[model samples]
Target: MKKVIVISAHPDDEVLGAGGTILKHSAQGDQVFWLITTNITEPDGFTVEMVSERQEEIKEVEKILGIQKTYLLNYPTMKLDSRIVNEMVPRISEIFKEVEPEIIYCLNRSDAHSDHRYTFDAVMSCTKSFRYSYLKQVLLYECISETEFAPALPEKVFLPNYYVDISNFIEKKLEAMNIYASELGEHPFPRSERNIKALATYRGAIAGVEYAEAFQLIKFIDKE
Candidate 1:
């Protein structure tokens, strides 16, 4: 089985960005792993109960998605910037060595959130083909709110060149996302169930599928 990893800036981002694709990999017997870069901590103004509840949500989603394992860096939320890149890269690189994932799905580098952008930078640092020979592909998945809200500069645009048909797993993705009750909101809210499904439907039409997830193929190495 191929090893796959999904790296996100926070807990709900994996679900928001690539949940269906993650389920597809698991169903296909690929060893799927999660790397969450930040956490809600008491120092971040979150109550102890809030931090505990977020952890519980992560566990529930892990069970629902059949994640092989999860690695949490536990960095403070909203504080991941270039200042900590040196500290973050080695820890992430160690996980890359441990997982040896052939495929990686990460947040878009140009996302609106500073956490997402820095997480992407740090993850990419660990993905040099010569250093991580097992890595065959790296793709960036768009988080609804962050991606769409990014500055309208051409270089910052999220141009999706890859699509994964997720018709069979969309409902399950929604199910997993719902575990993060604190993250979702009513319609018009980008992370809402309605908006998530709507984006899938829109992308499905472009791919001529019932439902799908879109991604930008950032890197690919053909070892053969």
Candidate 2:
């Protein structure tokens, strides 16, 4: 089984970004780990009950997604940009050293959320050069709302060149997403179940599959 890591700025970002792929990996017997950078429990205007609810939500998601392990850093939510890159990179690097993941998945750089952008930057910094030489491939997945709501600039557009067929795992992805009740909205909302399925169907159409997840490949080091 391959070692895999999915890094996200917050709890549900991974589910929205690449939940089907994570499920597919686990079903294939790969060891999947998650690194969530921020917790919603900060004093940035959230209540204790809300914090407790969000924590419980993630725990349920982990169980449903078959995540082998998780690394949760209690960084402030929605305030990742205020922190310096050096402060974030080392912690992620330490996780890399321990997990030694063969494949790394993270948020795309084009996301509108400041936390998402910062998380992508931090991941890039941590994996630069020979720091994590054992990494074989790196892929960036798009998060709904955050990625699609970005400005119409060409540089910020998410142009995915790779697709992973998730036809068999879309139901599991939707099931896992339902655990994050706080993050979901009505049908018309971007993070709604309808839109999530719609996006997957669109990607699958491009790949000639029933459902799929798309990604931008940042690097691939093949020793063969």
Estimated TM-score for each candidate: 0.98, 0.96
Write the residue-wise lDDT of candidate 1 on 128-221 in tens digits: 9879999999999999899999997898789999999999999999999989888899998888999999999999999999999999998988
Off by over 4 Å in 2: none
Cα lDDT tens digits for candidate 2, 40-137:
76478889889889888888988888899999877888888746556988888999999999899999897888888888898888776477877889
Candidate 1 worst ten-residue window by lDDT: 150-159
Backbone Cα, N, C clashes tallied per candidate:
0, 0
Against the reference, the lDDT scores of all candidates come to 0.93, 0.89
Which predicted model would earn the best lDDT? 1
Backbone clash pairs for candidate 1 read none
lDDT of 1 at 45: 95
